[model samples]
Target: MNRTFNAASTADDVLDGIDLRGRRILLTGASSGIGIETARALAAHGAHVVGTARDLSNAQAVTAAVLSDAANGGSFELVELDLSSLESVRRCADRIADSGPLFDVVIANAGVMATPAGRTREGFETQFGTNHLGHFVLVNRLASRIADGGRLVVVASASHRSAPFSLDDLNFERTPYEPQLAYARSKTANILFAVEFDRRHRARGVRAAAVHPGTIRTGLGRHMGQEVMEAAIEKLSAALVAEGQAPFQWKSVAQGAATTLWAGLIAAPDEVGGRYCENCHVSEVNDGPLGPFAEGVRSYALDPETARLLWRRSEEMVGETF
Candidate 1:
């Protein structure tokens, strides 16, 4: 594929002329933010998009535009899925698995950011459990439902730069709990899950890639106070200016979802499979100091051994094997 997109590109820009009439895609968190734009763009381009949400009523209200704006054969549907509950994940996955239509791509886009310290319905740390473990079970269970030449896109974050995942203390039982660090760990797990998943399924033509949608102001930040957010953004902007990069500014939802669409549908499978992608391209390994505004992926996020280890530990935690 030719390189024409940048951080400023929107989802529509990434798929400007692409036709997806016969394609089928599964997307999570379709009720808000980048997920809404992603579903809109895909369905507008004639793809059959099945979106999952925690509340069917709320999702329906927020996504009327998806149905109203579809062109050609594009369409959208919704299913109930609560990532914090394993039983809910299973029911949703099982229903989709039995529905008979194979998916051309599955985007694990639903997630929680830094929440006050808490646990999931299954007792794992809230961030790790909701953002990582929930998708782990849902995706692995639906593995065979993916088409032979398909894609799995996990929505990770650049915050993985700060994540040093520990096999021990995954639930923060033995150590001090920090909300941001917990979110960082979950983002790392998202990338690592893609790494190992691509390794496992690439032989059969299914490829997985993790994407960092550039920081956007969304409901994802509801837990953070306005003053705290402003201070952090100020500091980040100063750091970027010092490094001679553009001052920090949040991406539009359309811009934020561009990389997810590009990595999932536009980029060659071989180019993006088992990699970390941002700005609509595969990122290089950078083990340097943490830069949330930086471009390169940390070496640990794409480490094969660590990916495998996390896969094993995730399976154990969820009480299922893939």
Candidate 2:
């Protein structure tokens, strides 16, 4: 899709003049980094925001000053949501659903990257359970409740290009667990989830889009040391050897959140629904090493058949249907 923003664009830059008053939005991982900035920019524009964090006390401490930033009487509320736990995801969804406002936008911006191997309470891979299936359950719980013409934004990653997800062993029960591979698979699931969500709900006027928040320095790396993260980057850079491509550049928290804001608030619904966005535009499906800012979404992540299959799989995993 043709767009009006880029990597250097901040959340406020994309939100300029956008009157978000009365728009109800739920943002996950809002206690820190890009999530805070995204919540701040929308709140500054007069939107009502419910920001979720795993620890209520910590989130409250980090955001004690958040509500003070809102303009035009916009308000900010903090809620507990541990996406890694299905029970917590359900409780959070229930509380939000009972809050009386159908969300105008749901930003699934919370995620973990390259963490050491582990499983959620449900025994799914850590990255997949938290980043993909958790949000899958949360959104499904809220699907019927989102406002018509609303947006659901999944923050996926360019690492989805690193590997195709293995449907045969989604839990890694058969394959040995590798951190980067698991992370890539989870991210691919993010894109597929968005693609299928759009196909299923666009007719009802609810749209979904996935985004690649450009490489950024954040607490998302707290588990893996900088050297380990760099090792993963080297792996990607080596993949470019035959194609002669450069490594990805980094962005600040504000800039990292630009594409999410662009997809959720700035772009027209039909232009981006069911698409993967990067550098603030609908990205091409390119999974190979390529020129600057031309990184593509993998075909597997956008495959309608795989998306449907994953949908069924996710429903079974969560013990629910949308």
Candidate 3:
């Protein structure tokens, strides 16, 4: 696939002239930010999108435009899923898997960012539990429900470069809790999950890829107070400037979602499987300790051995093997 899209490209821009009639997509975090835009663009192009949110009524209220204005037989449906709870993840996956038609694509887009020290209902770190482990369990459970040749696009972050993952200290038991580092570790786990998932399923034609949506101001930052948010932004800007890269420029929701749509629908499976992508193109790996705003995948984030190890540890954490 040619690289025609950039950071400024919108989801609608990426999907233009593409027809998705009869396609079925499962998208998490459907009620907010880029998730809503992604669902709207797909449904507008004739795909049947089943979206998962913690609150169905709120999701319906927010996505009314997508449903009411769907074209070419496109449509949207909402399902309840609270990623912070393993029980909720299991119930949502079981309901969708048991209910008829198989999915053509699954976008694990829901996530929390820079949250205060906390634990999920299942006794795991809030960020890791919801952003990585939650999707780990849900996606694995639905693996059988995805049709052959299906794609899994996990919405990771360039901030994955923020910190290295520590499987041994997954819940921060030995380390002091720092919100940003915890979130970064979780994002790295997202990439590793995609790497391992693609390796495990590609032979059966189910390929998975992780994607960076760029910086976008959304409810994902609700956990960060204004002063902390400002300080973090200033620090990130300084680092990028010092590195001779442009300062961080926030992407709109549409722009943020463009890479996800591109990776899932436009890029060839072989090119994207087991890869990390951003700005609508597969990213190169940089082993250096670069600024979080820098573009490219960290070599550590894609190590096959690490990915495999994470998979094994994750299974043990959830007490279920895929």
Best by TM-score: 1
CA lDDT for candidate 2: 0.88
Better of 1 and 2 by lDDT: 1
TM-score of each: 0.97, 0.93, 0.95
Top candidate, metric lDDT:
1
Backbone clashes under 3 angstroms, per model:
0, 1, 0
lDDT of 2 by residue, 1-322 (tens): 4447877898888888889998999999999888988888888899999999999998888886568789987889998999899999999999988876789999998989878889898888899999999999998899988899999999998878877776888888888888888889999999999999999999989999999998888898777898877886677677666467665556888898889999998999998999999888988877666543457888888999999999999999989988
* Reference-based lDDT, residue 245, model 3: 81
Q: How would you encode candidate 1's per-residue C-alpha lDDT over 9-98 as one tens digit per residue?
A: 999999999999999999999998899999999999999999999999999999999999899899999999999999999999999999
The better candidate by lDDT, 1 or 3, is: 1
Across 86-180, the per-residue lDDT of candidate 3 in tens digits comes to 99999999899988699999999999998889999989999999999999999999998889999999999988886777677889999899998
RMSD of each: 1.2, 2.7, 1.7
Model 1: lDDT equals 0.94
| lDDT score, candidate 1, position 29 | 96
